[model samples]
Target chain A: MATSTTRLPRAVDPNTVNGWGVDADPRNDPTYPFRDRSREDGPGMAWQRPPLQEPRVEVLRSIEHSRLPAVVGTSTPPKGLSGMIRRAAFRYSESDWRHWLMLLGADRINVVEGIFEDLARGRIPNIPAEMGARAEWRHNKLGLVRKVAIVAAVSAVAVALLRRRGRDDW
Target chain B: MLAAEYRGPYRMRAGRKRMPRIEHPRDALVRVTRSCICGSDLHLYRGMVPDTRVGMVFGHEFCGIVEEVGPEVEKLKPGDHVLVPFNIACGQCHFCKQGLFGNCHEANAEATAVGGIFGYSHTAGGYDGGQAEYARVPYADVGPTVIPDWMDLDDAVMLTDVVPTGYQAAEMGGIQKGDTVVVFGAGPVGIMAARCAWLFGAGRVIVIDHLHYRLDFARRYCPAEVYDFREIEDMAVFVKKQTDSLGADVCIDAVGGDAAGSALHTLFGKAMKLEAGSAIALHWAINSVKKGGIVSIVGVYGPTGNMIPIGNVLNKGITIRANQASVKRLLPRLIEHVQAGRIDPKALITHRMSLEDVSDGYHIFSAKLDGCIKPVLYPNGGQ
Candidate 1:
């Protein structure tokens, strides 16, 4: 690892940045204008906490939080291979890159799982439509064509190699 | 109440939702007049942000009329027209006192990093956004600013996020007199950043993007030099050549996550999902800046890490500054700028649709169709 000395910039004049002192006028201050300073020392967020929403589905909690927040998103709970990967990811600290990388990887895996699930349910998945390829074709025709060609070429080669391997096995 | 709900990736619908009530003493309910589909909102619509639940309303940029207010709210009253800042900050927090309202400790207390954001998903404290007929704004005294009589309602809505974010992008650059500033991505924020760089005394401003219409728009709007990155072979080389081989003094990575350029980044980040989003713009910024330049990032990235060129940052001795723009801190100045006609935030609005057609709005904006730069939604009706 290349360890470098951290160099802090000299104290900058507040005026150096544009619009730095533009809010100096008390009258123009949006949040608090001419408010008594005494209120600053008082307790913040004094409102009573609302009733927590029932977690109808599995809510993934980060390792950093001691408990689930008062409100948590319950949509698309962990399931399938992607869900397992996500569950494993939650085990690690969110600060760790592995945790995030795992989740991102799970997202892609989830897409594939979704397609498989759709096929299993006797519904032909519109991969192009789902991937927003129609819009891509309209807006970025050349780029979309290039991407499709690449995928086609790669798939063709992969299929040919698989067939050769089957003949060798026989 | 009808609100734009997230069904899944690339899916949105204007659906009937429960009317929001002031749950907290400091909360206020606002009848949304005009809301916008921000570039950052596409991240959630595209299923990039974590914990984006189905049926969650997704909007953070809105201007509205206050329908009701809790007893504790002092600054705003019922029937007041206000532009709500995206960040839901408690005024008394340590960060908020320092004017870093985007990192308020009291709001979004569960996770470390980023304050509460309305309609930005669970990752942003799960506060339902203003894409609805009415939205419950927490910390009413701290965030929403009464729209001045002189300001257009469209302009006030943009200030909630885009204008301030773009301004902060340039501000973070610490641009000195006649310094060369290069901004990546010609989206609304990028165009605004390019324009704001001139405000900070930048001699030359350059914008980079793949889209022709957006580049043309940036050229006309920012009146800065624009380049189609698709035409350029190497972004770093092109930037260096433009700046007499010294490189730009400041490079702003206004494009984050969904940036397309490098095949390696696309393969790993988007296809295989090894990283959060493609850090191509960030890479270009780091590589294209001068040895001791500043790379300011106002672009939205996933909470997780991305593949970055930290080694180049160390070797080049670059100063990297990034954050969710503290909208509250910049609001007063921004309001004045809009009033003075220095920055016309409303000019960016190229498409306007009723809230019922939010799905189509999302499609047009996301697809980059009909030369759509910024699409605004009127929940009640157009003014």
Candidate 2:
């Protein structure tokens, strides 16, 4: 006894069907399943509660005024101790040093390319006198190639910890 | 102009395109008027999402009208009717000024994996979605909204993403006053996360699935307790033998990574893609919650990781929580839980077709056939 069948392929078009348009509106199609006409069974919500978290108290009052402290005043010059030892040895976060200098390929973010070339030469200056002379010539050529790659990685980790303390002083 | 067309894995096709505009100054466009078909677009229609781009156009929830707005759009105009929110935020970023609009650090160029999800492809911010008949909308007054005048564009297109991803999967399952909760996928975001876990006072909710028509449509639309984990054979020991084993204080995993009864997890996550599909309902919500429970996870995995057990979520002291549903910070308490009738996101739409039969509504919703749960799609030039 054998009985086999396989036909499926004509993906669509039984005359494009076209009926449930505004997602069914014969007054919302006899309310087919609007959870059996709710408002907990009537009066379509004569205001009984809900809506108080007023958009979570206006998004926590705009995240408490965007965590305050940025009243827009920055004319550069206040980083004394060699810019706090280069912000504590480049410990990142200006959006993680612009995504780690754009994953090391350096997508040129000298403060967003000196604020888009000083707003395309119309100058809205924060520190743009040729953006502090091309950011002091790209921070003195990236601080002499990051201080010679951190003094050649701390002199190859202090010569492998002094050759393991000179073989434990032999 | 018809649309949708991915062309590969479980192929989608639809045809005629090109008609979107205003590429930026905070673009707008829209005109879609309803578009659904999300279960995270079946993880890019089963190729299991990862740079899914063969002319992509899947729909990320949807709802429309505005039809043009860009010179830096000031809160929508030309004919309004909005509803967007499938996270593409950028209202001056630090995560959309901390309402964490789904982590929008300038709308996803993989904002460190996931943040811009419209048509769920290009790992989510390659834009292009609203399954067609127009849709551009980036940042347009921080993710659409409008649709109020007494709602119902089928309940504002399930408030753009299955009722704020099933009300943030029962508000990240904190579910206090009676907490038992359970969930796992019965699908329209697990019947709105078991009807928002009875508005978070769940003394017991349940759900599970293996489909007896989505456990009889989450037992007539959720006040929970539906089952059929293929008639349980150790579904985390039948949910800790129905709770007294001190389990379920909350366990969500609304079925991400295409989970299904394991046959070595559909032969290694749907035929050897390695991982990111068969997490088997996050390994049965980290082995059926309890010892310090609270799982949550509004499902849709595959930005690459997932084979999770994490030593049963660190020895079941669980807590987890998950995201992608910040839908403009839960749209004014889900439009006042749909105008206080208390949640009726269009009774989870059963089916409706025509954006020129969107490839037969994505082949009867990726072949679950007739008892399909949510479908909706319109866009035949706004009918």
Model 1 chain B is weakest, by summed lDDT over 10 consecutive residues, at B105-114
Model 1 earns a TM-score of 0.78
Clashes of each: 0, 2
TM-scores of the models, in the given order?
0.78, 0.30
Choose the strongest candidate by DockQ: 1
Per residue, candidate 1 scores C-alpha lDDT tens digits across B264-373 of: 98887666656677889999999999888889998888876688999999999998988888899899988878877778888999989889878778877887887989
Full-model lDDT, candidate 1: 0.78
Q: List clashing residue pairs in candidate 2.
A: A39-B341, B257-B277
Any idea how many clashes model 2 has? 2
Model 2 CA lDDT for position A93: 32
- Number of the top TM-score candidate: 1
TM-score of chain A of each: 0.63, 0.17
